[model samples]
Target: MGGSSDVSRRRFLQNAALSGAAAVSGVGIARRADAEGAGGGAGQAVDPRSTEASGRVMNPIVPDFAGEYGGKVPEFQVPKRPMGKTGLQVSILGMGGFHLGSAAGQKEVTEMVAKALDHGINFFDNAWEYHKGMSEEFVGTALKGKRDQAIVMTKVCTHGRKKDVAMQQLEESLKRLQTDHLDVWQVHEVIYYNDPDKIYAPDGVLEALTAAKQQGKVRFVGFTGHKNPLIHLDMLNRGFAFDTVQMPINAFDPSYRSFEREVLPVAVQKGMAVFSMKSMSGSGEPIVHGALTPTEALSYAMTVPGVSTTISGMDSMEVLDQNLMILANFKPLGEADMNALREHGKQFCDGRYELFKSSLKYDGDLGRQQHQFPTAEEVPA
Candidate 1:
């Protein structure tokens, strides 16, 4: 709240709406920190604000967690893996940027990120559109002096329109994240049938992305989509190699539009890093519906062969500890184990469980027009 005050919450939300995200209701921003995790199940209420120092937000990692987590510091030992051929090693478990933005306060989100890094988690995920860029801004705060320790990634949701507009989006993201360049910059949410084609069209966002890479504003370029595996393949078949590809690689995904079945092989053949998310069905809906336990869902995703790293949204230290524990004791599921788990999840594999694949709810550009560049007067000097 302190550092981000330069852009008021009103402005943040207003810009968010203009950028294509509708306001989120029932976010529990008013909930008290001590009241976190009160629910015993999937619908359990999450504390929107961090229990960290109230209003003392924005700074690099401090040696103390006394002001956060009710005075308990999280500790864990995690492993790192190569993210394909990027030459960057990432923690087996990466932090999700969306849920971090959902938390009420900047201090809380920053502390969660610091805690994750303190415990050996080095990969931090973000997006320009997440929480009106508050997510990237918070990561910027947490990584202020410790940026080199983390492999940071964020996305752009430009719908593959104007190359200059997409370039502006990247510049805006860089300013929000307080970084001159990103470790990886992805084209976000390519869900439609023609999404890939648009990106490859003349003066498309891909032009800006590649030019940025050449200019050192971005080290790598990739694309992310959970809606359809075909869209993922469409991206690859369109030409222009990628350094990574992010997609849903959860337990139930094998049965639905199946990014795993359709896209994983292609990504592997291309020698691109396989980044997996929505392992627990994005927002815990599948786990809440009893499709699979969190461990089972995550384990299923991790052992899916060719996954560089599996990311899960963790809003609290409790969730982070549980995931770290899973990683520490993790043993890749054997073929039989994979088969049985997939079978168990097959029942709930209907598009209902994996809603992103069948609905425009997760598509960032559904009702919004392509983001346009501002007039010359609006451009910064």
Candidate 2:
């Protein structure tokens, strides 16, 4: 466990970064990775902490996965960065909201949130639809007296509904999060093809975003989606101003239809706080399938230049401790190393690891119902 042996793991990562796995034709195992992790599916209440990491569907690219796999939790402070043009300094890492509901109970959520705050995490991501409002409730209870210490954000799931629906959801989100005002309020799951049109229509959710800010109910407003890059682009091109944008970012993203490649630069150019999610391929498929180590996946996502914070889900203390340990020994991957990792990810770039884009698997049932799309069971991917 000494830092002296860093070279072996680093070298192994280098090899994996440059590797293409088993070539594009050898994509069968990738499918199986999707299947094994697909049981609970996405947008569900699966505890992210329970993902088993040691034995995987495939052998690792290298056998030197010793040090990064498990390590002592460090008490050092996690780093912070500027939140785009918002002028607020937030932790480079954020605590995802959904997993809070999936945690064992209120005690676990309390511990995880407390630990996250102690480690300098100030940005918390949540949505109105997550865990049937349980996620927001847990985050609310955990942050009772310490509200001022965190930058709380939750999405209003209007989903093509009228402005009134957005407003109602906002009020409920406030009640569930136990806050009178939110640091950030976002339009959740702008995934459907006509989302932009619907949101920009007369008396749409965009108006709600404006009214929320004007009424001092929210400080900033933005939107989030993990679908096509074009959908995000469409949202950006529309007339309304957005304070932030959230999307999936990972090593595998650069090789495929990439939000980093297409939308990230635009959001950065617009001076929006860019929050990254799905750093571990939405459900740790790459790690569980031995495609990339957790360190490599997280490092790549956080290392992306324009990212304000990388939001990762931790349903148990173990996952949180692992993340803390990674941050303690953190170092950015160089541009060349990033490219190598992207090249390595080309093998699984077929959308197996990042199922949010590939299938309707990640879409929430509410969103599906709103969009008139199929259920999670119908399209399990």
Candidate 3:
């Protein structure tokens, strides 16, 4: 199993710690029990893509996460979408980098990447800081013979450092990813209050982005953050033309310090592709707490307006399979369903479930070190 699976379970445990509930995953993540009796009650394992042998629809979920999925869904490919004006096609399900690094080994990472590609998941998300370059290395090695089929995206973690630092990190990322150019290179984790000011400063990382594009080292440029929407707005309003922007997009976001409410429209208005992360409330907090089901959370993020794709953390083959099934059969939830989910998520709007915004749990150690803040261990949520 991937170590990220372990970490995810731990985070789920911690989140469920608040409610004393059991854990879930991309697979173990429990879905809603159909009011019309979809399957084995609320926690029944049903194939998400299509009907199973019992001629049952995959609507509900199984809380018994220890069991393997004994269901089968129809084979289908994930859909592609336009990535803003970059004119690049991106997958609705992008593979996350941190968990790619956390997989057991290169072989496991290769398997996951291959499965994703076979299903049309071309957008691979990564970072220069993930696993100290191990994530980039695994992705590089995995895409060795299939680089042309993937839209690889990685982030530079200057964390308010100079443009020189960003440029150096880009070089390292290219070397580690074994690529001549990055399809999308972004400014990683622009969460700090003064991050925008620092990035726009003379000789800042934005200069590195412009240089990378000018030098043919990267095809597109953007920024990402999971903290406040105000911070993302600050980045957007900085007068620089970004091709893409990423943020946390989930049901709870609408009720809390909502990036969906505050930033989604602005980016769409600016004609920028908006990539979503932390669809399951950064750690399946709501799922474990029995507020939102796994499918509901994933479906909601995938259907959020103006979102190009929902970037998910799939560390294991089981997780990958589950997410693929969800994507394969994905239909945009109706306006009423979407609004109902928003109302359902209102209870978690206090930042308890979304700890990435409210706490230090999802804060990277490298970012904290660069910012001179205490480690997550020192001051955890």
Output the number of the lDDT-best candidate.
2
* Per-model TM-score versus the true fold: 0.77, 0.85, 0.83
Candidate 2 per-residue lDDT, tens place, 63-156, comes to 3222343344657788899999999998989888876666788889989899899989898988988888998999999999999999998998
Which segments of model 2 are wrong by more than 4 Å?
1-40, 43-71, 379-381
The most accurate candidate by TM-score is 2
Sort by TM-score, best first: what order?
2, 3, 1
Quantify how close model 1 is to the true structure by its C-alpha RMSD in Å.
13.8
Clashing pairs in 2: none
Better candidate number, 2 or 3, judged by TM-score: 2
Error of 2 at 113 (Å): 0.6
CA lDDT of every candidate: 0.65, 0.75, 0.73
Q: Model 3, which residues run further than 4 Å from truth?
A: 1-69
RMSD (Cα, Å) for all candidates, in order, is 13.8, 7.0, 9.9
At residue 52, give the lDDT of candidate 2. 39
* Model 3 worst lDDT window (10 residues): 33-42
